[model samples]
Target: MPNPDNSTPPIPSSVLILGSGVFGLSTALSLSTHPSFTHSTITLVDRSAFPAPDSASIDTSRIIRADYADPAYSALAAKASKHWRGEWGADGRYDEVGLCLVADSGKAEYVKKSLQNVQGLVKSGARQAGQGRAGKDSVQVLDTREEIERVMNTGGGSGESGYVNWASGWADAEAAMRYCRRKVEELGRVNFRKAEAKSLLYSGNKVIGVELVDGGRILADLTVVATGAWSGKLVDLRGIASATGQVLAYLDITQEEQDRLGKIPVLLNMSTGIFVIPPRDRVLKVARHAYGYSNPTRVPHPEKHSESMVVSLPRTKVDEPDQWIPREGELACRKALREMIPSLGDRPFSYTRICWYTDTPTGDWLITHHPCYEGLFLATGGSGHGFKFLPVIGDKIVDCILGKTPEEFRDKWSWPEKGKEDGVWTDDGSRGGKKGSVLDEEMRKGSRL
Candidate 1:
């Protein structure tokens, strides 16, 4: 354990953030916005070139709803929604389409809390609005099953359903991230670049820098590993975090169908694990969130989770090698849409791809300091729900680095949860390799419109 300079600075003079996705970029941008960090040397690194094509943050649209069973997210989303309204606005980037919460029986813990929270907030806002106070929180009950079916244009679209927070909508994720990166760069202290971080460069009990995949090393006073799904490989995250693959398909609906369902809100079928995003430019997105794919026996659960950056490559082979959408995923998605929006017809998907999620047990992000290494921080563990907090999550990261994170959320993001038992690869049987991958022939078709 030799020190590069045998120095340990109380505050980081230079900060290196790995990954350029939503979490990494947000932390970088938030650092630049800070009064002291404005002049600090900050570098944002990414494995891919500008706007990584396959990055989760590169999706065409991202849901901005705050309908979480946990009120922390709901309240935070309420705060960020205000900024999105004033800043992003309806300038072709953000929308206020809201999210339609549909459930199998409507009694699910997640769905029930969502409806109660949203409706309560909406009523509170309404009372305030009557007294000359105005806010965006708005909720509307679908009333009868007939109304839900009518909205979905199916005889039985959902058993229980409602719309939450008319202010909640979808945002162009890539556009927003690009905007944030530009703003961070304009601050003059932050630089964005393309480079893959191989591992952490440690000296004694402190992390001094990161080793690049290209044999070069970046030495920084503080290093933040925000690489998301790729995080476990570079560090011994153990079960605290691991990569799980999910599917996303882009479908092109007829103008008639688009007109009918375009203005409709996002479809969140909590039971069916299908999320049908709002139709944008006649292209609708369908995503499934449930049991996912992991590195089967190749990656077993680690006994302890920590800040150790040891490269333990997972050998478990993914069913879909070329990253194509599988037939299993396709059929499941179609079935969900068919049940939810029967009017859309049983058409084929235009484009589909598989994406990996860095999952955690509680679904809370891991934005805390490394237990074993000084000058090292863990800013990953998005767990598939990290995008919506893009606007403010970075600020909290700064707080954690500066020892200012609020008391309530610190434990949730910290170690020793109920069950950090992850890193095991569980297959969902969603791949239909018989036709090769989805990128092969029929899965993705160029838009003919």
Candidate 2:
């Protein structure tokens, strides 16, 4: 018989986090700060190295506070922005430089509607919470294309003619992730393992521990899976299922295109369905929002930025967060950016990278206790906005671990009652008829088209 001491200690409380991304680290840091978690140990597991040499290579940081059309996400983002600047320390890593939404004259109506809702929400509760305060609230709304042009001129124009907002920006993504990870590591209660999780050890319906790729069995009282893209595969082993999404990013311009891509406020070009983020140096960042691949797999190692360019090659099912840069992808992204913003012209791209998103049919993140497992928690399906909510997610995840469900958390991530098969259902307008779930009827009303 196995020694009783070797099994989980009676009333065990240690937590095993199954990824090193922002979600895993953020949860570890928050648990350290939690009053009830003083005695708990947090074991963070990630295949990524400790102190990633290239921050961007590990996970590109694209932080923003733009309120989404979805109210639930807006609320979550507002809380996250506060924690990033307040809890994580403003000067630590995340910088609130503000963000702007841009659109062409033809799509002015769409931009206006979206911004109206965002502005209303911001002005209503966000301002009271100090989530955002537009440049003295003087020019919160840019009604004219000429005004946008003037602001664009001052911010080192996007190279293309379009209307712009003045009071928005982006955070240093690479720096923010690094800072969060560092803070978590500094907490003496947590241990980061440089190994991959090979399988889960379960008893009856509960997970008892995880078997590492190296064959070490590190047991835990509870397990939290924040595996991002590899989540589907990891969960599949345990009979849990999720969808994967593939995303890519490209440098906006090279060092030579200083006049065109530098000093620009981060922009979300609604007309083009693209987001343009201004990084340090002359390089700008650009990527499509609507286009993405489904059924992505994880790659144990990072890939180069070059391998991602070929549209012909079967899309790689990267299971892990790889940083390989495909040369052709780098060239293609740079060219596409130039086409979008003519000012980029013929400048070369310095680098490019790919990342993955855990997706859901209802488009809401699945961050709760596993429906079937008693001691397992989930923090996945951010729908691409998970990183921005790292700070707030940490607090909620810890609460879930401690068995105290907060009111705010209950409202945001409550489990769906419908669509058990494909995990999809249309919102039926009940008191709990939240819009961002698998059953959201409104958002996908015409999805068949």
Candidate 3:
């Protein structure tokens, strides 16, 4: 551990990863299967079991949509969408309930381009023989607010135009992760440790390993921190990332209601910051796509970075007991749901969870080396939209570690100035400005946090 020169040690025979969420597991699995990574030992460490209950990735459902106002993200996600098809023997992993984009204007960048993008892919694929059944009847543009409401199976969207990628739908997120998990386990080169990482073990500016909560040491040539909302507590990301909770509501429906709500497409209204997923197993998931909560149960970072703080309020399943289903979050969700599904607004929520996103300055992900510590890298900041890209995000992280990241995504995800990015008029700074918070903002009294 005498790496005083601050230079990278060398080609790592072993990789020690913190957190077994999507990023951690996928990166390990991808590296283990890579021809170049032969014989390399990849160790994945987490505080809880795989698919931990509190992991944002452990939800019963998560939206896997290509609906985005940005073209770059849309293109990347659209290509990765195909892998959702029946992953690991689970049928309908990529359900066909349709991905409906509902926004205030038919001309919204996300609305217009997503329609063209999916439609183009379908038509182009149709021309080539031996194409899979992924894009048949894929895209449909709905003009007028009433039309959007009609497709949404409700009656409140009064001014919007959007489209539906009818071929696209939600993914059984928890199931897909388990599938990948089994595959990783089969590799045998990757080991899972149910231990919490207390801090990074460094040698003069070079990361030599990680220190576990139990006072254990894990030495590796390279250490990648893929911890989700808890990333800030483990390393120094320099304020580029923070943990913000997004709340989702699940409503229990009777068989009759399920028959009607089950077919509803993943309804996303970009203007409203909400989306409704298709009902499954007599339950429907609806969530606000904005920042929900910002309580830092972990030590606050002086620089306000994710890797520098550890969030302790979350468990393997949900947020802290006191943080569950705030009255304000529920009201906001109900209002948004009523806009698209009026019946859902009338029904009480069966349960709620705040999906913690390791949010960053840009809507893009962070998959780069740690500038402060050599031989250490980071691959988090899913920004609430990382699950759907499961098919390929891991390989990208490997590329980041190997210095092979494509130019398009390289700098966009690099560290940023949090104070500058989180300035006034800049909501979450991931997608757009004016993000919602979980504090039940007292807007009525002209008082804000």
Candidate 4:
């Protein structure tokens, strides 16, 4: 990847981002927004040109507002949602059509339990804030199918029913990404470069900068790896696994059919592990859970789920950053959707896309310092719930980089957990693993600079 034309002034500080995905762009946006970053040069390197709506070149349509079943994730999502609304202003780009989690009688029991759990957290948070009523109003558990239908119709402005409502929602991924990038550009110091990082440049144990694929080197005082699925290639040089997971989407219904289902809330069917989001455009975006993948070297499932990536891909390399288009066997997924909804059986697909997820072994986010590498930050292993936290993920990373102690994050996003005698060092580095070392070396290096 080439640097900006030499005719222009050099970047203030060489902040190099390896990937141009949502996470990478979000981090850059957060940094560019900081008061101290007024003159700090920030560069975002990616494989594609600036993305736009309807551009198949880059798929940024992965954002969601669904709260997770896990406490760590629910807390993270809650924070991210707040940040998103704050930054975007009222109706910035996301449509808060609310989220619907549909399930059968048996699966509804699980949904009910999960709703109870989320309600307890919300009430607890509000009570601490001195609010009188429990926030349980946000997590109503619908009993009758008619009640489910009424909630979906009235809540989402769709005027239709037959969908269960959950305490979650949807956002326009492309719009949100563009909003962040525009905010970054507003700073004028942040640089958006079209490049691909080849390797991390290191001075002994400390990382200095990144070398691009096309022979360009961008120096950085601090380097962060927000490269999502492709992070493996960048961090494995330091001996950490990136654990790639595959995700696929299908638009089985026609544009007319999708329009007929206008503004439907994002629906998550936990029983089948499928999510259907109704975008403004005449398209229904459906994605299945990343069950697991046989390539354990590239992916790890904490739930003991069966491997499903290879089974999901279409012969060609689908997991790569630039190469993801549906081929074969994707129709089977559409067929399954048709079986579930019945309305989708005859409708032709608008388009199908495949995406990748970077998973950690423990299921919790592996937001930690790179072992043995100073000045390098590793932000991967978000599992499948990374996008839901995009609004605050960048802020947290920036907080970490600024040396300010993020009290909540410090207690939550810890070192990866070790499973058995796998020899994988998963400590927060306080007990037996290496944690504080990276920060210490980074401080020392910065002082020398």
Candidate 5:
């Protein structure tokens, strides 16, 4: 919780942002040009160079849709859709192909509420104007599996009922990220550093800055941690935030197959948490938006001395370059392929990777200042859906930093209370699959296969 008086913190002379992913990079961009921060020095640091290869932000594709069950997120996503349709989406960066969202009888609640939200947006004409070819008829409800199959055009259907939002689409994630990075560089207002942050430099209760892995120190008046899944290691986020690794499997297809499937809408079944984004460049992707595997490791608690705690952090290719998803995840993806696109059922996966998400208990982002630390602020907890807001999230984050959090997101983005007695598993009605999976255990199980 922020100060009860609602007094805004003084604008710092120097702001140091850790992590160059969507949150950090966007904050830097916003801080650089914002009128109030004209004299504030901005420094952006990341372990890898721009577009960190192992980052969740660096991906082949990401969904850009506003079909959320929560009206706030749906409205905000619709606002971002406008930017995606503008110059930000130029040069093949974005595509408005459409998204087929479905769910079976048991898990149909989310899809039902999502459909209603989008329909409301459409009826209010908010989802009509910038939808390109999907104008006016942007959303269409599918009453049966046959209707879902017809919209998918894949000769198959998923879930019992759903709807298709043509206004929704996908984006070349890396391209859009690079575009934002270039825009940040062109401003020349930020000092970019390629270095790994070891931990936060705490001066009593106030965070002074960051300590580098090489025993170097960089001090700043304000520090923002936007390290995504890696944030837990830099801050004590135990019950507040954790890293969950989601599985992604890609298959190489022929040019003809790509052309045939590329025109179809992105299919996502909330019931099973399986999704297949249309193929691009002869490669098709199948993934799950479920409660992902947790990689729990013991590390020195950020704010405690001679004490350690177990936190679920990311274990990516950056640490083990040869890493692949667990067999259970692979099989889940296989099942999705067999049921959705039967033609590719027997095809082998060209490659598989685990995409890490910084998940909070409620699926809301932690964008407020640390409840106890004076100079420390957090801008993470993407929970697998932050990429779509890349175009506009930074400015909103800056607003939160300045104590002007948008009314809609004030409570949603605030520092959450301690998690439940069992553990933190996002139950936002969107995530599916089993919870409480351990990464190492799953990997060993995969080895047995």
Candidate 6:
């Protein structure tokens, strides 16, 4: 385990990054361009090709907002929003339709703090600089559900009160990921391999590289496990971080409906963790950002070969191709649709899936060197809010690798002390819904119905 002291480690000659999602891919891009790692050989390996179908990073749309209960993350997201307004967001990849964030009585605190943070950012002129016409006078407080509905421009809306940050928006997730992958390919410095990491290759206590599922070893001077939800399979995340599956249900709409709904702001209710990103390609998605279902499974311990441990890992369509969101999730999505957009309440979901997030108890990302392994670094723990930071997260991750973690995130992203798995649900205030829902149990219950 590495200490949290500001002591720089020598740049490795070869760096192997496992996983190609935001964390891994961004690190690869940053390492390929960073001067310190100019001579380093970077290899990115993932179970699937670029933009894995089951990855949380690949989707129809994702919210892009600077709104956060914490000022630090709000500021960071505001900085990232600048990039979303620029080249990274071009070519129909980003949509600046604004984000309407609301909350009920029970969850109003998070919304209140988030409003203050975004308002502060606006006051400090840290945000709204590059947002064009949409940037000016962006933060608008919605005192009631009616005001929220007005901002949403939809017939209905959730939450008792909230605010709308006109500067915020949404992005075409898959397109942005593809754009990122293409940029990495253009660099030509990284070697991208499509292979599943069976386990970490270790020499004593240090991770030397990764052993592929196919029984081949890829050695590197440093190994970065950025496998997102499946990181627990490679590293004993245990109570530090776990994989939780969030629900997403997409409904197909008529062209007329799309035209009408396309211009509406992205609506999110923090109380229920239900959100509606405006329609794209006549497909409207309703998702929950709650304390999601966990799929616990026993697997060989990465550090101890003879022992196996139960960890909450992702069981996506990749593993069960026909898998769908559990009935509880579907009903939640249905209810959200009825409350948020009454006109489409009866529409059937064209598709539904569980998106897995690498969640930490504090909702902070886990981005630091392994506490016990000298050559292993972890760049995971997205905690459901990592996608918007895509433009700047990589460089920040690189800084951590060089022992220069940002002052604000130094503690937030560091390797945390392990706790009991039963007590590890994220209490970030933003998360909603009942805790401790097991995926298998939920699926079995759904099957019974």
TM-score of each: 0.83, 0.73, 0.85, 0.71, 0.97, 0.98
RMSD score of candidate 1 (Å)? 6.7
> What stretches of model 5 exceed 4 Å from their correct place?
1-5, 129-136, 421-423, 447-449
Best by lDDT: 6
Q: Give each prediction's root-mean-square deviation over alpha carbons.
A: 6.7, 9.6, 4.9, 12.5, 1.6, 1.5
Report the poorest 10 consecutive residues by lDDT, candidate 2: 425-434
**lDDT winner between candidates 2 and 5:** 5
* Residue-level lDDT tens digits of model 3 in 1-449: 12222233445788898988889889988998887778778889998877788888887777776655555666666667656654532565656577777666533665666666556556656212112234444566787776777766755552378876666677888888888888889988898899988778767778888888899999998898888878767765434666776768888988988887776677777655677887888988888777545544546452333534444223323334544555666777787777667766688887877677777655678787776667788888887889988888888888767776666785666554454433111233223213544333422323211
Q: After superposition, how far is residue 38 of candidate 1 from its true place, in Å?
A: 3.8
Model 2's alpha-carbon lDDT is: 0.53
> Model 6, range 271-322, lDDT digits (tens) per residue?
8999999998899999999999998899999889999999999999889888
lDDT for 257 in candidate 3 is 80
lDDT string, candidate 2, 114-189, tens digits: 4665666567766332323444441255555555545544323332333333333456666677677777767777
Better of 2 and 3 by lDDT: 3
Residue clash pairs of candidate 4: 1-214, 13-41, 99-168, 149-162, 244-298, 429-433, 429-435
The candidates, ranked best first by lDDT, are 6, 5, 3, 1, 2, 4
| Model 2 stretches astray by more than 4 angstroms | 1-12, 51-60, 83-92, 95-97, 103-114, 128-139, 143-147, 154-167, 237-249, 252-261, 295-336, 403-412, 415-449
Per-model lDDT: 0.67, 0.53, 0.68, 0.51, 0.88, 0.90
Candidate 4 global CA lDDT score: 0.51
Error of 3 at 331 (Å): 0.8
In candidate 1, residue 315 scores what lDDT? 22
Q: What's the C-alpha lDDT at position 97 in model 5?
A: 88
What TM-score quantifies how close candidate 1 is to the native fold? 0.83
